[model samples]
Structure formats: C-alpha cells, structure tokens
Target: MTSQSSLATEDTPPGGPENPGGGSGLQAGLKNRHLSMIAIGGVIGAGLFVGSGSGIAAAGPAILISYALVGAMVVLVMRMLGEMAAARPTSGSFSAYADQALGRWAGFSIGWLYWFFWVVVLAVEATAGAKILNGWIPGVPQWGWALIVMIVLTAVNLAAVGSYGEFEFWFAGIKVVAIGAFVIVGLLAVFGVLPGSDNPGNGFGHLTDSGGFFPEGPGAILTGVLMVVFSFMGSEIVTLAAGESEDPQKAVTRATNSVIWRIGIFYLGSIFVVLTLLPWNDASILKDGSYVAALNSIGIPHAGQVMDVIVLTAVLSCLNSGLYTASRMAFSLGQRGDAPKAFAKTTSRGVPRTAILGSVVFGFLAVWFNYQWPDTVFDFLLNSSGAVALFVWLVICFTQLKMRGIILREQPEKLVVKMWLFPYLTWATIAMISFVLVYMLTDDAGREQVLLSLLVAVLVVGVSFVRERVQRVR
Candidate 1:
C-alpha cells in the first residue's frame, strides 16, 4: 500500500459492475491557479478574523507566541501530509494513506471522524453565514437564511469540483484581500502616517506597555492556544483539494512549499499589526474584534460594519469548503469499501452527487438540531468534533512516520515533498499535540472539547473494528 503502488494507475478507468459506486471517478477540473489560491486562502478563516479578539484578550500580546507555536506545528503536520498526498493524491488524503500505512481501522476511523467534523462545520458555518445575511435582510428568518446558504453552496459543490474550486477561489480571495489591506493600513497607522491623525502611533509598546505580554500570566498562552488552534482547522483543505487538480503532485508540492510564508505573513504578520496598532488589552478589541479594532484605531469609518462583510465572506468560504471536504472524504471512503457503495456515485459532471447530498442532509439536520436545542444537541456536536483537527494531525504524523519508511524503501522517487527532520520532527509534532491535549484537560472550557472528541474518536474506532471483524467473518 505504498503510494507508488496505490497511485500507479492515475488514469485507470473506473470500476466495473462488481464495484457499484466506483463507476466514473472524480474529475480533475481544478486548475493551477485554483490550487495556489486554495493554498493561500485556506489559512485565512473566520476564526482568525473573529476569534483572535478573545485570544488577544486572554494572552495579551503574547498570543502571538501561541499562534506561532501552533502555526509551526501545523506547518510540520502539513508537510508530512503533503508528503503522503504528493505520493498518492487520493481524495481521502491522509485517511487513505493511513489505510495503507497503518491499518483499515485507522483509515476508517479517521476518514469517518474527519467527515463528521466537516459536516458539523457545514451546519456551524451555514448558521454563522446566515446570521450575517439575516442581519442585512431582516425579512429572512435565521433558519431560512441558513437553509438558503446550505442550498446554494450544496449546488456549487454538486455541480463539479471546478465549481467548488472557483467559488472557493473568490471566497478566499476576498478574505486574503481584506486581511492584506488590514495589515497594510494598520502598519501605516502604526508609524503615524495616516492623514489627519497626529497620534504618534502606539508602536511596539503595546506588547509590554500595558501589563506586559503575559499580563494574564504564562498559563494563558496555552489557553490562547486552545482558542486559536481551531482557526487553523481548514489549512489542510489544500491537500484535500489537490486531489482534484490537473497535476496533484505539483499542487501538493507547491502548497507544501508555500505554507511557511503563508502562515508567517497571514497569521503572525496580521496579528503583529493588530497588537502594534492597539494594546492587546484595549477594550475595543474584545468588543469590536481585533481586525475591526485595528481599523477603528486608524479612524476608518464603519470599520465594524466593513469587518462584518468580510466575516460573512469567510463564513461562506468555510461552509463551501466544509461541504466539499466532507463529501470527498465520504466518496473516498465509499470507494475503499468503508462506507456505503452509494456514497461513491458521481454525476455525469464527476460530482459525487450522493456523497454531497448525504453530507448536506446531515448538515441540514444538524442545523435543525441547533435551532431546536442550541444548548443541548448543538453543543454536544460542537464539542464532540472540536478536537478532531488535533486527532487528525496525530494520525497524519504517525502515518507519515510509517509511510516515510515505506516510500524511502519502495519508491524513493515520490519524496518530492519530504517532511523535515523525517522521523524526528514527526515525533516532536506528536509530542506537541499530545501535550496540548493534556494541557487542554486542565481547563474547564477546553476540558469538555478534548473529552468529547476522545469519546467520538473511541466510538468511531470501535465501529471500524466491528466492521473489520464482520467483513472477516463473511
């Protein structure tokens, strides 16, 4: 199950009657630009825009360190994932690699868990996006707006991979542009360059001037990590999306190569501007959000309103990509015989119609549960999937460690995007994630997320084991 053997026939024809849903496979409609943008835009999410306010408030300016730590961890994980993805380029991404490198149990558990995570994200993002729309158009009820957002994005994904890519391209473009402008303008204002403002820019004093970077105490940095790490959840979309690109290996390579600079510029760079423009303790940051507060500090009119529009775009982008990621994972699982055969079915346009519809149906139901019991069912769904990103990364690191050996021995040629320090950094990443998980248990807010996620993980693994045993008996 080395990548070389798994992807030996990239152009092979579809499965025959014996494999019901594996008829015509997914189309490679994603272009070079699509991959590049997905790589760039996937890192910029609504979390960075909205959630950072709370991070800044918690860890003060030192939240930058929290982001840097998590960012580095993610970069390593993606490198490892990119290595496997470049070698195989399956729509299942790490899950497929896990199947080959680990066992069917690992693949089945992770694929289904990842699918569950994103489908839940579909409901969350849909509702978040709907709130913005409902704000603009008061006539539409919140649920109606949620339904509209889900239906529209579902249509885009069901059309074709290219449609998803193109829509994500623009959605991500808006986020990139908005953040880029925010960083630029905030920098200019930091140096007292903005017109009509005599304020001798706050400079770097904000990092220490208030109560110092660790005003909230050193422990808060880990708390900040808990708050911000989830923002990095969708960064793996590049690896997932690359499977549909015209040249997947090239896409994976380029995406992997650019992750460092992307995280540096987008996450650290933007947060740097925000902290410099205003103190981390600035009440406005907590009230108006870090980005909007930065905008307001420079006297930008309607900064909050402007940020709402950008946040809406980010929400829509997340929903669109979430649906795409979940459906593709389901499709891949079906192809691997880990899911229902119907999930692997594709339309004439090469869209996984059944997979997309099935994921959306669950998303719609989740949205209903959210409206009906925001405190009960929705909260459980949210907490249960909250830590799956960390779990997925853990699986990727272990898979790559094993897969790396196989790739090196069997097919050294597929090592275009190798993980740095090989087994060393891979092991370090696992340790770091484990430390984070352990650290999460010490806090009330993070404790439930980790516990619930572990519960879900255990349940999925149990099901995989049962499935394997049942198949063996037959």
Candidate 2:
C-alpha cells in the first residue's frame, strides 16, 4: 500500500498553489445550511416517490424488509466512505482514496465510470423533468422542455457552487416537507383520526389482509432489492460536495452520522405509510403510483398533481447534483494525471469550467440519444451504467479496509468517522454488495444490466492499464 506521505507527494491539496488556474481551485462556497439540506435531500430521490410502487407490487408489504435491508447496506457503505472522506477531505472522495490504497488503475477506472454514470443520469433526469413540464404546457414539445430544463440547470451549475446549493436546498426542502406531510396524514388516516380521510381506520391489516406480508413469496424481497438499490445512488453526493465546504471533515462526519435517520425516515417511514394506507397489491399502486395512491386514499385533493410537482422538484434536484458530481469527478481525475490537464484547471471563481462543460456536453448528447434512439443507443446507455452504484460501494469497502490501517499508522487524529466493527463489518458490507450483484443475475432485467455494466467496466479498466503502461515506458 502507498503510505499517506507518498500519496501526498503524488497529488496537491485541492486549491493548493500547484493548481493550474493561477492557483485557484474549488471554492468553499457551500454553507452549513446547504450541506445539511444536501445530506437530507440526497437520500430522497424521485425514485422513492415514483419507483417504490413496483417494489411494493413485487414484494407486497414485505417490500419494507427489502427496503430495510438495502437501507442498512447503504448506511454501512456511507459510513465507510465517510471514514475515508473525513480523514482526507478531498473532492475526489473515494476515488482519491482508491488511488492510495488500491492502485492508480482502481481510482482511474472507478472515477471515469462514476462520471459516465452521472452524465447518463443527467439525460435521464432531464428527460423526466421535460415530460412533466410538457404535460403542464402542451405547447412546447417534450424534447423542447428537455432542452429548456437542461439549459436552465446548466446555467445554475456554471454560475457558482453556492447557486447550485441554494437551488437544491429549496428543491430538497420541498421534497422533505412533502414526504413528512404524507407520512403524518397517512398515519392519521390509518388510525381513524384524519378529518377528511376517505380510508379512515384502514389499519395495519393492509400488511397481511390480502395475501400475507410476502404475497409473492420470501424470495421476492431479493427482487425488490434489485428494484430499489439504484435509488440510493445519490446518498453519497454530500461527501463529494463536502470538499467545497468550509469544513469538509465536519461536513462528511455529520452527513455520515445522519445517514441512518435519513434513510430510515425518508425510505422506510414513507414506504410504511404507503403500505399501511393501502394494500401492496392495490391496482391503484400500479396505476397512479404508491405515493399518489396513498394520498388519494386519504382524500387529498389533486393528489396526483401534488405528487407530480414533488417529483419534478426531485428530478431537477437530481439533475443539478448529477452535473456537479460528474464535473468534480472529472476534475479529480485531471488532478491525479488520470485525465487531461485542462480538466484540472479552474476559473477565477474556482470552478472547473472545462470539466463542467465536458460532462454537460456528454449529457446533452445523451439527451439527444434518448430522443433519437430511445430503444437502441439510450437503452444500452441505461443498462451499461445500471450496476455502477454497486461497483462504487464495493470499491469504498475495500478502500476503507486498507485506508484504516494507513491512517492509523500515519495520521490517527483524522479518524473522526470510523467504520463500526473495523474490518469485520467492512467485510460484511462487501459480501452483501457482492451478493446483490450475484443475485441480480438471476432476474432477466437485472442480468442484462449486470452483464452490460461489467462489459463497460472491463473496457475502462483495460484503458487504464494501457495508459499506465505507456506512462511507465515514457
């Protein structure tokens, strides 16, 4: 393993005098409120609002178990990432740690793959947001709305990191409030107390009245896991954003510690309310979605429209963070000599302009592909990057395992966020991630995603090895 001192020799601190843009680097533009909201909002995605229906449909009320399982895994992974990130406080985050603990190739491959994943997400979220805008104003075509949303958010990101954080703060705040309100109302309706509830006294029978908790069978929980795992992708975005905060270490520590409640309340608490408010196998769930169906059960006026607004906020927030994350990853790669030097350059405001434009350029192309070739090229893009969340978590696990000893031997004071149970829980988290990847192969849709993602990963790793060999020869 590369010692801490050796890793320091290889890379300058972000914003250090060695930076190419006359020594300017990423600014500490994000404030405490921005970081706090980001941590809360990162855990709640449009997927929770929109995608949980299918998981509920698949696993019945037992989808709770699937969610709890995945939630535990995410908490563990974030803890490990927080441990490394708190110690080092780099925008590169896990990718930087991987360079020191694993190898340069490990860092290079994962960093680019992560960047690719978010750029592709930019296309997905932009299109989703467009569909909503076009629904409200039919005059503009769906593609036009897509273009408009992309341009607006791209401007937000390019303006300053503070602008991005401020926008996300409100977007995320809306989502947090929405979910909180839904849970409170749903609970009231369940216990026969809500004043306007249509489904008063629904009770917990919804958990087992229809066909028991595991209506599909116990194994469906695993299937539900496959469905919900991707939703957790953005939970670690705060760690990356922390590098630009005034106190990266404190930001990382707070985000990590709070992850448990974030996942518990946003995911488990909301899903429980939905399942309790209505049956898991309710046709309305499959029809209008879980949250909408739950709201309608409580006699909320225009529940579907309310959810549409919330989902739109979520899509825009995701798009904003996706661009920010992809650019930072590219910038980190540039700093480590794994990407073009221009990517490492920051503007007078300490923004990586080249990196931001490069990520958004691919994002724009991806949006075009979604419109032009929805089935062929765009479908491939989606499937090819589907498993990257697992890949990233897995890398964090291994990196933390190695980094723990190195940090202790070198700078033990930085160990503010330690992984529970040391190597044992770290190893267990690794096993769980591996098991999920292996389990994905059993389902047809998941099999295709895993295989395609593996193929892309192999190609990236091969390129990294070749690049390393050429550097050595020179």
Candidate 3:
C-alpha cells in the first residue's frame, strides 16, 4: 500500500504537468473579489432559505444550536483543507491530499463521491429553480425551465472559469445583500425601532414563549442537527476554487480565516432574526417558510414574491457552482489517472470542456429522473448522496491527521493555516461525524439516507480496490 501510494503521488503531481504556466491547465481566472464573494455566498444556500422551515418545525428555537454546531464543524474541516491547499493548492483539493496521505483508494473514492454529490445537486437545484420560474410564467413547462437553466449554466462553465467566477460573484453578492438586509430589518423590528413594523420588540421572548426553546425536548437539537447539517455542503467550494486563482495561497488563507464571520452572520444571524421576529411555533414559519414568514411579520409587503426571487437566485447559484465543482473534480480525477484521460484535456482558454460536458450530462439525466420518477429513482438518488457531506468531512479529518505530520517533516513553513488543536480536534471531528451517522440511523428518513449513501460508498470503495488490484497485476 505504501509503495502504491508513493507511486500514485509521483504520477500525479499537484495539479499535474499539463500546463507549463501553473500547477494545472486551469487558468488564474478567479480574482480576489470573486474569491471573497464565493466564500461568502457559498454558505448561504437555498436550503437555508427553504429547508430551514422543517428544521425549525422539528427543533423549534433550538434550531439555532443546530446551525451553530454544523457551522463549527464546517470551520474545522475547512481549516484542515486550507492547510493543505495553502501548502500546495490544486483543483483536486483534498482528494489529492488523500492520495498522498492515505492511498490511491482513498483519493479515488472520495473524489468520485464528491463528484457524484454535486452532479446530483445540479439536478436538485435545477428542478427547484424551474419550479419558481414556471410559477411565474406558466406557459413554459417546469421541464423547459430546467432545461434552460442547465444549458445556460453549462455554457457559462464551458466558456471559461472566469465566467463561472463572475456569475457567482454577482449571484453570491445578491444573496449576501438579501440576507444582510433581512438581518438588519429583523433586528429593527425585534427592537420595536422599525417604523410601521407589525412585530413590535418581542426580543428573545419568542425563544421561550411557544413551548420553550426545546419544545420537542433536548433530543430535538440532534434532530435539528440532522435536518440542518446538509445546508452547509457548499461551504468548502472556495478551497476547490482557490487552485485557479492568481494567489491560491492567499485566497485560501483569507477564506479560511473569514469562515467564522460568514457562517455567524448568514446562518446563525439570519435564523436568529427569524426566531426573534416570530414565535418558533408560529403557523407562518412552517406554512410560509422561515425567511418569508419573518418578512411578513415585519409588515414587508409581497414578502413571498420577494423571497421567491432571492431563493431563485440561490438555486441558480447552486446549480452554477454545482456544475463547476463537479467538472473540476472530474478534471482532477482525470489528472490522477482515476478517470478518462480526455477529462484532463483543457481548451486553449483553460476550460475543461470534456469534463464539464460529462458532468452536465449526468446532471441532465438526474433531472430527467427527477421529472419521471420523483418518488422512486429520484428519491433514491437524493438519499444516496445525502450523507456525502458528512463523508467528505470525515475524510478531511483523517487526511489532515496524516498530512500534518508529512508537512511538518518536509516543510513546516507551508503550514499557514493549521487545524485548531492538531490530532485532538481532528479526532473530535471524526467522532462527531461518526456520532451523527449513527444518530441518523435512529430516524426513519435519516436511516434510509444513511443506508443508501453507505451502499453507494461501499460500492465505490470496492471498485477502487478492484481497480488497484488490476493495475498491480498489469
């Protein structure tokens, strides 16, 4: 295994030698401003906008705790990723580190699983954006909207990496502005300072008013954790993108350092506004969704429509990043010889056309399944990919453990962004992730998701070993 890993590491240097100018064939198209927005906007997903309602319904006001817990975990995971990425930035990100630290199977399995997760995300976001667009214009069918979204984003990705960054910069900027405005308005209403506000200075009373913070019991916090954890999936996208930036090291360092404020303001802060503006058990929360309901409480006219526009932007942003992320992972896999060689080939402009098309093709198929079999096949795809965020975080913990020692031995100065407490916190994160997976088994819906995701993960790991054996024989 050691020999195999060493050989694999040598064969696939960081980013590969495909382009003489940089680490990889990818160009330095992402500017510092683009990186800043990507880091800020990546945390504020459509899930926080739409899906948090169910989490609030499940855990009541304690949902804030759920968001905080998940937020902290993401911070630690990103720090580990930043340490490696800053030391040696690459589009492959943690997968490349896994190859060097653990073995070939580790890198191959996680890379493909991460790729699978994003492609599925593409379909989900496409459908979501389609629903909103179709509601606005009923003449175009939902499928038509989905097709249009998929094609437009695919073109943006294929054109150049900068197009993706530029589009994301605007998309993420809108989301940040929307949430920041919401938090500000919510605070005003909560303090009875906003003129013409219906919700007059309830303060934290709503936190305990309905059934108390833990209406469902303290156990509900864990349930909320399970519910809200996936919303944080896109937070690490900055690390993957750092490879294509002009100063990969600085971009990663800045992103890693700012993760705390981003999550605090966006997830925790926005959710705090919602809880304070209205009771957790308010019918409007579950009925209209959290953000929209909060806006309605403050006498914001057309709150639903306003939120629809924001959520649609978020969905399109996710779809855009999803396609870019999945394609880049494919390109990285190809660079390492884990995938088709053509995937590593880039256009003159440094766009991985083949990899982008391959990922989008799968995404289009997933969209078709979503339309044709919303409950059966499509549901399975969702469940099978549901636990991937946890899986990726766990791998980063383990990879960082091994990688920390390697870096210290070879070149300690590269450790610009270290994991907080070394092996101790890393182990703690692994334990937390393991506990969540085990906790997931107790709930019917979570159980199905965990089992299905595990089935797919096991199958992928098996394939990696088999491929390794075949290579050894040859």
Using TM-score as the measure, which candidate wins?
A: 2
> What is the C-alpha lDDT profile of model 2 across 1-474, one tens digit per residue?
343422752333434325754438788889989999999999888888889999998899889999999999999999999998888877788888888999988899999999999999999999999999999999999999998998998889888889999999999999999988888888899999989779957689789988998889999999999999999899989988988887788889999999999998899999999988887888999899999999888889999899999999999999999999999999888887888989888877778889999999999999999999999999999999999999999999999999899889988998999999988999999999999999999999999999999999999999989987897799
Once fitted onto the true fold, the runs of candidate 3 whose alpha carbons sit more than 4 angstroms away are: 1-16, 19-24
TM-score for all models, in order of appearance: 0.96, 0.97, 0.96
Models, CA RMSD each: 2.3, 1.6, 2.3
Query: Candidate 1 lDDT, tens digit per residue, 398-466?
Result: 999898887888778877888888789999999999999999999897899999999999999999889
> What is the alpha-carbon lDDT for the whole of candidate 2?
0.89
Show the colliding residue pairs in model 1. none
Candidate models: Cα lDDT each? 0.86, 0.89, 0.90
Give model 3's TM-score versus the native structure. Answer: 0.96
lDDT of 3 by residue, 193-282 (tens): 999998878888999999988899999999999999999999889988987887888999999999999999999999999999888888
Which residue runs of candidate 2 sit more than 4 Å off their true CA positions? Answer: 1-6, 9-17, 21-23
Q: Distance (Å) between predicted and true CA of 316, model 3?
A: 0.7
